[model samples]
Target: MILWGRPSSVNVQKVLWALSESAVPFDHHIVGGKYGGTDTATFKVMTPVPRVPVLQDGDLTLWESHAILRHLAGGVPPLADQWMEYTTSTLQPAFLQMFYELVRTAPADRTKDAEALKATFLAAVAPLEWQLRKTQWLGGDSFGMADIAAGAMMVRACDLCDPLSPQVARWYEQLQTRPAYRAVVMTSYEELRA
Candidate 1:
C-alpha cells in the first residue's frame, strides 16, 4: 500500500495516525502543500481533486481521508460513522478556522478575533467533551476509528485550547503514550504555519 500527502495537513495526519495504529505496512510519499505535484498528470489520475492523504492499495486508489480511514478499518466501528461525520462537519471546520485565523493569517492581517475563534473551537468541543466525560474513548472503550477521527485534533489544541478538561486531558494522556500517536500526530506542524 502507498499513501500520498504531506504530514502538515490535518486530513493527512488522520490517515497517517490510523495507518500507524493499524500497523499497516505502507509507503508514504510527500505531495501537496509546498511539495507540489498534485497537478501532475500522475497525481491527477490518482487524486480527482488534488487532495492529500490519497491511498493506493492493490488496484484501488482512494482519496479523501475519511474514506481511507473506513477502508483501512475494514468497516466502520460502532458510532464511528456518526462521530466521523460530526467531526468532518463540525469539529474540523472549527479547527480549520482556528488554525487559519491564527497560523495562516499574518499578524498584521490578523484582524479576526483570536478569542472568538477559540470560543468557536471550544463550542464545537463542548459536545465531544460531554461525550468524552462519559467514556474513555469516543467509541465507548477501545481506541477505534472514532478516536482517530477526533483524537487527532486534541494535541494540536496546545495554544487554542490548552489545559483541556479533566476527561479530555486524561484521554489525551492515553493517546500520548501510544508510539503511533507520537510518531504521527505529535510531530511538529511548523510546516503548516504561514
Candidate 2:
C-alpha cells in the first residue's frame, strides 16, 4: 500500500492514525501542500480531484480521508461513521477556518478571522463534549475510527482555542494514551505551524 500526503495534513493524519492503530504496513510518500508532488501527471491519473491522503492498495486507489479510514477498518461502525460525518461536515469548517487564521496567517492579520470563527468552533465542539460525557469514545467505550477522524482535530483545537470542556479534555487525555494516537496524530507538525 502507498499513502500519498504530507503528515501534517489533518486528513492525512487521520489515515495515518488509523493505519497505525490497525497495524497496517504501508509506504508513505509526502505530497500536497509544502511537499508539492500532488500536481504531477501520475498523481493526477490516480486522483482527478487532486486531494491529499490518496490511498493506493494494489489495484484499488481510494481518495477522501474518511473513506480510506473506513476501508482500513474493514467495516464501518454506524455510530462511528455518524460521528465522523459530524466531524467533517459540522466541526471541520469552523475548525479549519480558525486553524488557517491562527496557524497559517500572520498574527497581525489573524484576530478578526479567528474571532469570527471562535463561536462557531465552540458550538461545533459542544456536541462532542456532550457526547463524551456519555461514552469514553465517540463510538462507545472502545476507541474506533470515529476517534481517528475527530481526534485528529483535537490537537489543533487545543492549540488554537481556549480551554476545552472537561469532558472533551478528559476524552482527549484518554486518546493520548493510545500508542498509535501518540505516534501518528500527536507528532509535532512544525512545518504546519506558522
Candidate that would win on TM-score: 1
Judge candidate 2 at residue 129 and give its lDDT: 88
Residue pairs with colliding backbones in model 2 are none
Global CA lDDT computed for model 1: 0.85
lDDT of 2 by residue, 1-194 (tens): 99999998999999988888877799999999988998899999999887899999999999999999989888877888899899889888889888888788777766665666888899999999888989989998888999888889888788777637999889889989999888888777678767
Q: In lDDT terms, how accurate is model 2?
A: 0.87
What are the C-alpha RMSDs, in order, of all predicted structures?
A: 1.2, 1.4
C-alpha lDDT of all candidate models, in order: 0.85, 0.87
- Candidate 1 lDDT by residue in tens digits, 51-125: 898999999999988899999989997677888999999998998888897988777888888888898888887
Model 1 TM-score (2 dp): 0.95
